[model samples]
Every structure is written in C-alpha cells, then in structure tokens.
Target: MEWKGRRQSDNIEDQRGAGPSMGGSNPFGRGSGGGFRIPMGGARRAGGGMSIGTIIFLVVIYFVLKMMGIDLLQVMGEGGQTSQPGFEQTETASRRSSAQEEETKAFMATVLAETEDTWSGIFKAAGETYEEPKMVLFSGSVKSACGFASAASGPFYCPGDHKLYLDMSFFDELANKFDAAGDFAQAYVVAHEVGHHVQNLTGILPRFNQQRQRMSEVEANQMSVRVELQADCYAGIWGKYTEQKGLLESGDLEEALNAATQIGDDTLQKRMQGYVVPESFNHGTSEQRRRWFKRGFDSGRLDACNTFQGDI
Candidate 1:
C-alpha cells in the first residue's frame, strides 16, 4: 500500500490497446454447467495449424487416452494447448481519462515488482531459480492462455502460459464500483493472482484439475472456493513478509481485508443481481476470503496456508 519509487518488473507486457481474439473458450470455465463455448475467431497461429509431428503426436496420444477411457478432446481441451503470447492488432488509440488509469498502472508495476522480489527470494532460498512470470496489462479486452477475457473476469494467472493478465480498470471497479478503494486493496489483487502462480509451482494446479475431474458440480465449485481462499491466504503470506521487512503501514492490512470482502462472491452477486446464491460461489464467501487473508497475514508461513487440507 505504501509502495512508491520501488522496483518495477521488467516482465510487464503492456498490451493495453491491443484487441484480443480466441479459438476455443469455455464460458463457464470448462465444466461449470450450462456449457459455455467460446466463439471461434481467426487463427492466432498458436491455436491454428498444427505441425505434422504435432498432429501425429496428437493421434497417438488420442489412442492412448482412448485406451485409458478418457476423451482425447476433453483431455486436450482441459489441458489447454500452449500458445505463444502475442499482441493482436494495435489500434491507433491513446490514453484517455489519463489521471487515474496512468497512476494505477505505475502503482501496479511497482506492486508486481515487489511480488517478484518477494517470491523470487522465497524460491531461491529453496534452491530453485525463480522464473519471473510476465504480467500482461490490458485496458478493456485481453488474450491470455486461458482465453480472451474482458475486464470482468478480474485478474487471473493463466497456468498454460505462466503469465498473469490484468485489466487495470478493475482498480476503479474495485474502488468506486465495488467500494474497496485503497492502495493496499489493489496490491492484494496482484498478490492473489501471484498466489495462483505459487499454486502452479507447488503442484496445486494439477491436483485441482484432478479433483475437478472427479467432483460433482457443487463439490467442484466448493473446491474452487478452497483454491481461491488459499490464494487469499497466500496473499496474506506475502503481506506478512513485506510487513516484517518494514513495508506496511498501520492501516495497510485493513485495506487488504476490505478488498477481500469487497470482491466476495456473495457481495458481487448481490451487487450484480438482486440476491446471493451460495451454491454458485467459486471464489469463496466474504467471511472465508477475509479469514484466509488474515490467516496468511498473521502466520507469514506457507504451511499456515493449507486451505486445501484445512477448513476455510
């Protein structure tokens, strides 16, 4: 929250004005029921035109998957194919509503740098080199390994590409729109996504995929809630480390808590619709989110964030 004049990550890909397109997108995030399908667009070279070897490899793998009683299409679909990150057609657009957007971008860059520093050191201490993931900054729409997403998907870390995508306008959406306006609140957003990256590192992503495969609709949603809550806790872990390193002000932690509550599934649903549906929740409830974040903030240890094996 008190970040300024700090290091900025060189890994930021500023694709703010670039338009995005997708090949196959699951609107409900692949198996959320009602079957969401992404409309096809012109091939982005990444998803189109498989090489001969790639085709043969797919053919062989398909039979192997068939022998294992798995749908090759579903397997390939769930295990998203690797796509090269590229900016789509760049329009001749310039910055508008300059003040808030520009400043938030700078602040986001600084925050991302701090996360990189924190996570990189943590990984290095474990004797593994930390590969810094790229953060794509977009304005309205952006293409990611996950698919094409608008500002509405919030911030997400795409496991397929090991990069994080964000639409900076969400800061205002969080502040004026969601009533979670604070600098620390914004940092928490970035930290939560980075927490997803940590899950990727800890093999939690693969485990989640397996669980999702075996879960019922309601149970899978609950699993997703646990995953998201764990991310909130992981964000708190980052907060604790930063605080110990003399980086937090007195009210900073509260700012993050306010954020955790602001974007809670029930709160967001009520704001968007007229009521809350507990069964449809994927990111956890307000209490669960705030508690997990506070847990991480208090403990500062990754072991304390075993939201997968523990109660929310």
Candidate 2:
C-alpha cells in the first residue's frame, strides 16, 4: 500500500481510447455479464446508446473482451452501434478517473519490480535464470496474442504473449462495488495475474492446459480451480514483498482476502444468475479461494502453492 515513489513500469501499452468491435458469448464465456459488458467495470469504452454505463453498454465491446479477431459492426451509425471508436469524454477516462489509477499503476509497477527481484533471486537460488514478463494496460479494449479483450475479462495474464493485461477500472470496482478497497487489494490482483505468468514460465500452465484438453468438462473445470487456487498462493508470495517494503496497512490483508472471496466463481455466479451450480464452476468456491490465498500468504513458499496435488 505504501507504493509511492516506486518505479513505474515502461511495459504498459496505453490503448485506453482504441476502436471497438462487437462479438459473441464472451467467446470462452467465463463470468462476463454479457455482450458489451466490461468484466467488473473495465470492458473497453462502453459508450453510445447508454445501456448500462458500467462498461456494459458500449457497442463493439468484443474488441476488448475475448478480443480474438472478433470484429463485426463496421458502422452501426451512432444509434444502432456506431462504427467509430467511441471516444466520448466520459468520467472514467477524464480527470475524475480517480487518483488511484496512477497510484495503482505505480503500485503494479513496484509489485512487478519486486516479483522480478524475488523470482530472479529464486531462480538464481535454484541455479536458473529468471525471465521477467511485461504488463499491458488498456482501456475499453485492446488486442493481444491472446486476441482482443474488453475490460470484461477482468485482469488476466496471457501466456501466449508473456504479458499481464489490466484495465484500471477494475480497481474502481474493487473499491466501490466489491468493497474490497485497499491498495494491497489492488496489488493482490496484479500479483495474482503475474502469478499466472509465473505458472506459464514454470511450464505449469501449458501442462495444465494440455491435460485439461484431454479431460472431461467436469474434470477440466476442476483443473481450472486448482490452477486458480495456485495463482492465489502465488499472489500471496508476491504479497510478501509488500511487507518487506513496509506496505502492510491494518485493513490491507482483509481487503485482499475480501477480493479473493468477491471474485469467487460461486459468488460471481450467484450474482450474475441466482444460484451456484458447482458443475459449471471453474474458479472455485469462495471458501476454497480464500483458503488457498491464505495458504500462500501464511507460507510464502512456492511449493505450498501446489493446488494440482492429488488432493486438490
């Protein structure tokens, strides 16, 4: 939380005002509310026609969400879905966009630096060299090796690109909607995504993906839970660096724990629909998520993050 004066990362690609492209059912269809909806609150520029304002109304949102070469409407013409990239002077991109975006970006950069330092030290300790990854920042939607993604996908790390993707509006959701507001809470999000990058670098993600492809839908969903849980633990390990920097505020841990619970597959499902169907779950239950994150926070050891163990 004490991230001021920390170094900012130059790896960011600010595509906040990019063009739009409409598309389908979340493509991979995770927890996104629906079309044109930015996951949480950062799905590109949800502009025009004024449907839901929460980053969920903007047409052509597919350009940001799932992104994967999905662009349809060329020019819906304003009322029907204008083709132009909606660059309206909205409050989000404006000055009122909260001082937190800059702070969060800086914090994320600091966290990245710490991860680089820690992981490098870790690899060196293990007689290997660490490969650092970059973080990409965009608003509305942006394209990547993983394809186009609206803020609807939330923050994710694409192993294909070896970079972490984030939309700062998610930080706003962390504060206002989820009530999991805290610098560390936001930091946890970055760390968790970066954790995915770590998993990719360690060959865990690919192995999981390969195995998941061979498994039944139910089994694959379970595998995703393990993967997500391990990422939580990794986030906790990254969080250890925060403590070393004297960044632990009293409510900080609670905020992060709250976040772990907030984005649970169960919680999100219940919020989006009405009930929780375990079969359709991929991210894991709230308690499961909280436990894994706590496990990582308590141990700060990479080995302890093995959610893929036989028992997981």
Candidate 3:
C-alpha cells in the first residue's frame, strides 16, 4: 500500500468535471460558460425554435429527473448520436478535486502503473506484448463507447473502448456502505477491472459473448460468474506480484479479501433485497470469490485462473 513516489500511469483521463454536452471538445478547457457546444454528426441539432408548451414539458421532465438525481448532460448522446471526427468525445463534468480526492487519484495512478509493470512482465514471459488500457476518472456520470454510466453502476471496464471507468467516490462508498476499507481494497478494485481488459486482450471476452448468445438465462449468468471470478483471480495474481516486490504491507491481503466478500453477489443481494437468487448470481458467492482470489495468489499463474474450465 506504500505507493508514494512510485511510478504513475500516463494513460489516465481526468474527466472529473467535464459533462457530455461539451461534445468532443476538451471539457477541461478554461471557459466561463457553463454550457458547451456539442457538434452533432448527421443528427438533429438543438437550435430549432420550440413552442412554449414544448419548453414547459421539457422543463418539467428536467426537474423530475433532477429530483431523481439524474445527470441531464449525460443523456445528450445516449440517443445514438455520434461524435464528430477528431474529438475524444468523453462526456464528463468538471469539478474541483478535494484534497482526499487528489490523493485517491494519485493512488489509482500508481496502482495502475504497478499493474502495468507486473502484467507487462507476465505477458512478455508468455511471448506476447501487453497493450496497456487507459483508465478514466469521472464524477457523477460519464459517457463512453459502451454507453452512459453513473457512479452508481460502480467501477467497470468497457471492452468496446478498451478502457476502465472509475468514479473515485466509489471508494468512499466501499468503506462506509460496504464496510471494505483500506488502500489495498481500492487497488484490488482497479486490478479487478484491469483484469477484465486482460480477458478482452486474450479473446476470452469475445468468445464468451459469442457463446452467451446461445445460452439460457441461467447458463449465461453462470458464464458471467466465471468471467467475473477469473477477474478476481487475476487481481490476486497482481497481488502476488506486488507482494514479491515487497509492496504489500501486513493486512493488505485481508482488506482485498474482505472487499471481495463484501461485494459478492449473494452478500449484496441479501443485504439489499433480503433474499438471494442463485440463478441470478452473476458474480459468484462470497466464498467462491475469496477462494478463487486466494487460488490465484497462491499459484501466481494465469492458468490457475481458468474459472471456466470446471466447477468454480
């Protein structure tokens, strides 16, 4: 957990306060206008004059969504609008980072760098070049190639864009709401998402998607469980590598294990809904998650994370 003064990844996109309406233009650019212009690609522009009734209706809908805590800017491109060419097209909002938020960002960058180093070596040993994925930092909501997502969806890896999206507030929620705390726990989350990128690079994700089309709901959910469990195991593989480098302090492993358990499908379902549905459990149970992570940590081999091969 001692990441200070360590190498940091340069692939981080700091979209903390840039909202979607700003279009492909840099949302972080200095501007006194809160509203930014978004270029529409072969789509209807927003300049048409509206009747009073239409404006009133839209205004009411806006207020209703605001009451529900929905971000209006994030919905701009969700209607299938494509960005103009030459624009990065990340729909994000700009906001000032708090002292703690800045520290968390630094930690995330350092952990990403460590994962890059460890995985690069692992991939090189396997006679392959690792293509490191970008990690995006956002607040509230963000738009990606995969679609718009809110922080409530938690941290996710979008294979379509080959990037990991994170809302740093999730770390606070992890500690306070899920009872999983510590720097290592946050690192575990990043590693797990990065593990998804690894799966994407190895063709496991595409194969899973192809096969999932032929699967029943329960079977597809089971396949998803395998995918998620393998990511957890991959996170543990990174944990093992960091431990070898003397980067992990005492109790760091426990924090990650606790995090895995706390976010298990069964534990979360029971806590939120008072019951657990096995057929709907896409990420495995707490025991399964903890066991797979430990298995990878103990063996430190990619082959040890073959969760799809047999019963997990």
TM-score list, all predictions: 0.73, 0.73, 0.76
The lDDT ranking, best first, is: 3, 1, 2
Candidate 2 lDDT, 16-109, residue by residue in tens: 6566544544665677544464336533444532345644545547566537654444333343454234535554466555565666667777
Q: Name the lDDT of candidate 2.
A: 0.78
For model 3, what is the error of residue 151's alpha carbon versus the real structure, in angstroms, after optimal superposition?
0.8
lDDT of each: 0.84, 0.78, 0.91
| Per-model C-alpha RMSD | 21.2, 17.8, 14.8
Q: Compared with the true structure, what per-residue lDDT tens digits does model 1 show for residues 147-266?
A: 888888878999989899998878877889888888888899999999999898889987898879889999999999989999999899889888987888888888899999988999
Candidate 3 lDDT score relative to the true structure: 0.91
Looking at model 2, report the run of 10 residues with the lowest lDDT sum. Answer: 75-84
List the lowest-lDDT window of 10 residues for candidate 3.
86-95
Each candidate's clash count: 0, 18, 8
| Candidate 1 colliding pairs | none
TM-score, predicted candidate 3 vs. hidden true structure: 0.76
The stretch of ten residues in a row with the least summed lDDT in candidate 1 is 83-92
